[model samples]
Target: MKRLLVTGSNGLLGQKITDLLVQGQFPNFEYIASSRGADRFDAKAYHYLDLDITHHAQVLKAIETYSPDIIINTAAMANVDACEREPAKSYEVNVAAVANLIKICEDRNIHLIHLSTDFVFDGEEGPYEEDDRPNPVNIYGEHKMAAENLLQQAACPWSIVRTILVYGVLRDLSRSNIVLWAKNALENGQPIRVVNDQWRMPTLAEDLAKACLVVAERNATGIYHISGKDMFSICEIVEAVIEHYRLDASFICKEASEALNQDAKRPKRTGFILDKAYEKLDYVPHSFGEGLKLIDEQLAKLQSS
Candidate 1:
């Protein structure tokens, strides 16, 4: 709680967490955000440690150097299709890299706040709870689920937070994120073909960062389901974006098949059941409309910039 380290500091969630920490909004005692790259930030308040989790020596070196009480591991090979194609790399980074980090943290008795995904559960029984069985349908989910199991079996203190359909963020220079893709596609007048059948709770990145910090502050352990307020289809999100910008609604249409070189099989519904979060973490996510409005507001700012 006092001294902390957050991996994947350049990622969507990582960046938001850094922003919150810099603004003194995060409840952590003291924080140091780590990333694989030397991405510069104006966070004059907090410390930054640039280290790649994929490298064992670097991971151990950072842990030794920082000597943090808590390590939040958000670094992962999260690209679904890419993971499907490169299963070995996915296992290496998402599973093996995390195992290495956990081993290092265990040696020091440091708590780990590991982020997971809703994809771990196949769409069969959606609105999944923390105790529900995970039967991953894709390689990405498979790797993440394996990592979760590793954390659970380990002797160290760990908390695994599983989330879904994360979005929001504008100028993130990272490669594996979804928000800028939607904005860029829309701005270019490209027809956004979204899957109407797929359902999920798309949590905004800002909200997600706050929720994570809340869990960290309360020293909450075990699995927690975190996401947006309401369920929505891909097409629904596209329509919301179109309406937000007052663009041609026809530009956002539903595709019959969501499959297009999709190496990883996606679930029709990966939305989370967040009653535990509400009760335990006191998490209050924004409604679907509210979430969409926030995205549109951010998009408007991006347009003006």
Candidate 2:
């Protein structure tokens, strides 16, 4: 049997992937989840290792020990503003760690599936295809782009899965997503300012997790644009959430991109075309409404438990 390892196993996508694996989603492979700290999950069906991908020696040691056939790298310094604030830390985690993984994969002949983001695009175009040029506007995107370049030029088997606006719930509530944030804010009757300019096809965490598995299963190569099919401005995204949960939208205040003096510049209109994924990987994503329905179900389960 083959062995599969995932970094950032405490994250939303990681947890979702773990959830599927526990349900026997990939019975042919053994699942090993590694994070920077102690395991946050309650499930014991898979092995968990405390791994900081930033440390080259540590990462090399772990890989040497685990001897995984495939590695899904979900670990990243994902916060745009945070990356902008701390360039050194961001590069260490996002770029250097990937270099380490690539080197190990090259030596071991391991297939690598790396998670990326839509922020690599400049937002000048909509529904980008696989071969579109990348012009990252911020530090986070720059680091991710660098990692992609390394993978593309590497000798080992590699796959890059780029997604947009991923959102979902974790049992520990360690992080918050757009859907959960909007629902909670509106539920509490708190007025919110949502940007009307930025646009994205938000991805469900579970859908992305499944996409990663499909890529590993097929050992798919090159870039695959994986995300929801629909397009919506940031404001429209919030409005849809409001509509889905039957919440009051009177407190929503629409704002433009410039007015929100954010630390990092975000792409104004960057969504993926996903034709290659549908054709090659046979990957299909849920609609924004359908994704919201799943989120509601998960939320209800969390509350009941």
Candidate 3:
């Protein structure tokens, strides 16, 4: 049986990957889910290991112990503003840790599938292909780009899955995604200012997980843009959320990206063009509206439980 070790198992993408492996009925795969803390999932059906990817020793020990055929690294210091404020911590998690994993994976001949973001692009030219040159506007993107560079120099077989605006549900996790955040604010008659200047093809976390699995199953080498096919602005997405939940739309204040005064500089139109992923992995993604419905169903189940 092929063993797949997923890092950041407590995270949104990692949890989705775990859920699919345990519940999706795919055969011949034993999964090891590892995160920094305790298992976040209510069901204890899979092996859970505490792993901190930043520490080289801990990373090396975990890999040596599990010896997985493939390591899906979903762990990242993803908070844009926080990454700006603490560049050192960001570098440790995003760049140096990835280098450590690359070395280990190289020696062990384990295929590594690393998750990345669309923020690598500067937003001057977008709908990026796999080969697009990256010019990151923020510390987070720079670190991600650096990690990608590390993989390029490694002898180990690797696949980089670059995604954008990932959103999904999590069990027993207080983390809020764009979907939930919008729904909550609108439903409670709370006002929100959404940016209309930026554009993204928001990826559903489940779809991204499936894309990662597909990459592993095929042992696909090189980079792929695995994100939603539909492109829309943040305001449009919030408007869709309001429509889906039948929430009050009057409270939403549409604003430009400059008005937010965010610490990190956002790419203006950095959505991916998925022709390569479509042709290569035969991957398909949910529409923004479909994604909202899925989130609603998941939320209903969570509430009832």
Candidate 4:
């Protein structure tokens, strides 16, 4: 079996990828899950490595030790506001670390599957195609765009999978996603403000993991827009979350993006058009409602466990 290495193994996307490889009955590949610290999950079927991708030496050491056929880099400084607060830190994790991985993968002739975001666009015109021009409006987007540029120059095989508004749960991770955030706030009768102007495809983490697997399995190169099929405003997403869980919708306050007083600028309408992914990888995404149901099932399992 070919060995596949995953960075950021503790993250939402990384955890989903691990779950799929270990539990989804995909038998063709063995996995090595790496993160900044010790393994957080209870699963013991795969190898876990303490990898800090921000450090060049650590990245090199991990790659050398694993000798993976493919590397799926799900590690990123994803918080937009945090990225703005610390631009240097953002570049370190998002851009510089990616450069390190690209160089290593190129030298070793390993296929690199990198994750990107829809924020690369300014959000003026959305549902972007693969060939659309990128004009990032924030530091986070700028860093991710820079990483994409680095991938474009890589000598080894590379695939950049750009997704939006990913949501799901992990057993030990404390990270909060949109679906869980909405459900928790509404269930607790807490009023929350949601942006009505901004639009996204709201990808399910599992769907994105599957998309990454498709790219890996096919050794597909170039950028692919992998995201949910349903498009909705941030407000509509929360409304749907409330509807699905049978929670009161009156607690939701619909507001425009400008009124949110967020430190980072957000795109108004930046969803992906997945035509290229469909054609190249045969990638299909779950609808938002279907994603919520999956979240419910996963949450139930977590609770019972």
Candidate 5:
């Protein structure tokens, strides 16, 4: 690859990509990391630019200016309830932004690797395969599925990576994931109601990052399912977190999905059958415990730092 540009450079997966390339994975490829605001990543090994993918003119100009060999689009309005509350805004980011990127990539012959979620499936029958028909049950899933549809029709070379329940700690701590949330709640002995009805194969941000680059390096095409090796209910996943940290589990109140009364209706079960990602991308994800162990170390390091 001549040049690889990543959007949402400040995000967990994007930062992990930067970490990889900085540590000499694909050392020769010129890297560009972009996000809407100022660069948040601490590494200066690669070029950083401010990019808001939702802004059409700016995105068009950036693509023309940099003309990267590959562009990994990781920026999206991912909050399900947020998407439900504000659909037009969500579409502008999730679907319309992707359309712009596809058009630009189509024109420039730049390979586009877009991040999607397992939510594309309705959770009626999953773990889903690569060719499984999408029937998104919520607005967020609908928009992501819509983006996937756009990529499928696009003339440019493209790959869609669908992941689930991504979790990891970053240097900047811009956001939190379920693992950390559970850890903190348990630490404080705060009673948190966690849903037991929903199930997922949680993904590590680093694993997802590696999977993306693997897809790009191997020139993989079509949809790839990338996530953790094991599946668990949300409550079980949290319990694992508590066990890993040796925190109090009495704080966790196991509850059904309906009790949460979330603004968006989540899928009952949506996991991916990763045989394609394994055979095609040579992708191997860490087990849930393995992933949590890494995070434990990272958290300690972060505390020290």
Candidate 6:
């Protein structure tokens, strides 16, 4: 069986991928899911480890111990505002860690699958293509873009999957992801102020996880923009969440600017053109409407449970 190492295995995307793998969504692979935490699992195939990739020795040790044929790096310091505040720590984990992983992967001849963000673009004239030049407005984007550059310069084969506005579990229980924030706000009879000016293609965590598996299996190298089909503003998405949850539509108020709360400058638009993913990976991204329905269904189940 081909062994695969999935980093950030406890994170939102990582957990989804782990579930899919565990439930036999992807067959014919031996999976090792590592996180900074997580202890329990049903079987021995799941090995949870405390991996702080900021330390090169720890990273190298993990890779050497796993000896995985494929390495998926999902670990990153992705808090946008936090990144702006702590740019050095962000670079250590987001950029330097990736560089170390690339070195190990190259030496071992392992296929490296790296996750990136749409934030890498400044969002100026967005719906960016694979070949578009990246001009990041914030430190988070800078770190992500820097990592992408490092992976590109590496000798080993690597696949960079850039996703936007990922929503699903493992995001903060209260106010982590945009969709959930809207859900909780409406549930608690509170109003939400979402920015209408910024636009992005929101990707579901499940879809991204499946896409990652596809990209890894195909060994497709270079950058691929895997995002939702339609573009939406933050306010529009919040509205969709409200509508889906049967909440008061008026709960979500549109804000003209995110500048007041946002510590770093955000781009007006930063979605992607995914024809390359379709052509190469045979990837069929979910439309925003369809994705919304899925999220609603999941939320409903959670409520009932």
Per-prediction TM-score: 0.93, 0.98, 0.98, 0.97, 0.98, 0.94
Best lDDT among the predictions, by candidate number: 2
Model 4 is weakest, by summed lDDT over 10 consecutive residues, at 19-28
Measured on C-alpha atoms, candidate 6 has an lDDT of 0.84
Compared to the true structure, candidate 3 yields what TM-score? 0.98
lDDT of 3 by residue, 201-294 (tens): 8999999988999899889999999998888889888888888778888999999888999998898999998998999999989988889888
Collision count of model 2: 0
For model 4, which pairs clash?
Answer: none
Candidate 1 per-residue lDDT, tens place, 1-305, comes to 58878898888888888878877786556888888778555456678877889999988987898898888888888888999999999999999999998898788888888999999998887888899999998999999999999999878889999989787754544443344565567778887667777788888888888888887888788899999877777777766666665667666656754454466789878788889999999998887667667766765676788
Clashes of each: 0, 0, 0, 0, 0, 0
- lDDT per residue (tens digit) for residues 1-305 in model 2: 78999999999899898988989987887999999898887598888999999888988999999999999999998989999999999999999999999999999999999999899999999779978999999999999999999999999999999999998888888879888899899999999889999999899888899999989988898999999888999999999989888999998999998888889999999999988989998888888888888877877899999
2 or 4: which has the higher lDDT?
Answer: 2
| Model 4 bad stretches (over 4 Å) | none
lDDT (CA) per prediction:
0.81, 0.91, 0.90, 0.90, 0.90, 0.84
- lDDT score at residue 173, model 6, on the 0-100 scale: 38
Give Cα distance to truth, residue 299, candidate 4, Å.
1.5
Give the clashing residue pairs of candidate 3, or none.
none
Q: What TM-score does structure 2 among the candidates reach? A: 0.98
Count: clashes, candidate 4: 0
Clashing pairs in 1: none
Compared with the true structure, what per-residue lDDT tens digits does model 5 show for residues 1-305? 47999999888888888888888887667899999888888677888889999889998988788889999999988889999999999999999999999999999888999999998988988899989999998999999999999999999999999999999888787879999888887788889999989999999998999999888887788999999989899989998888888998878888888888999999889998999988998888999999988988888898998
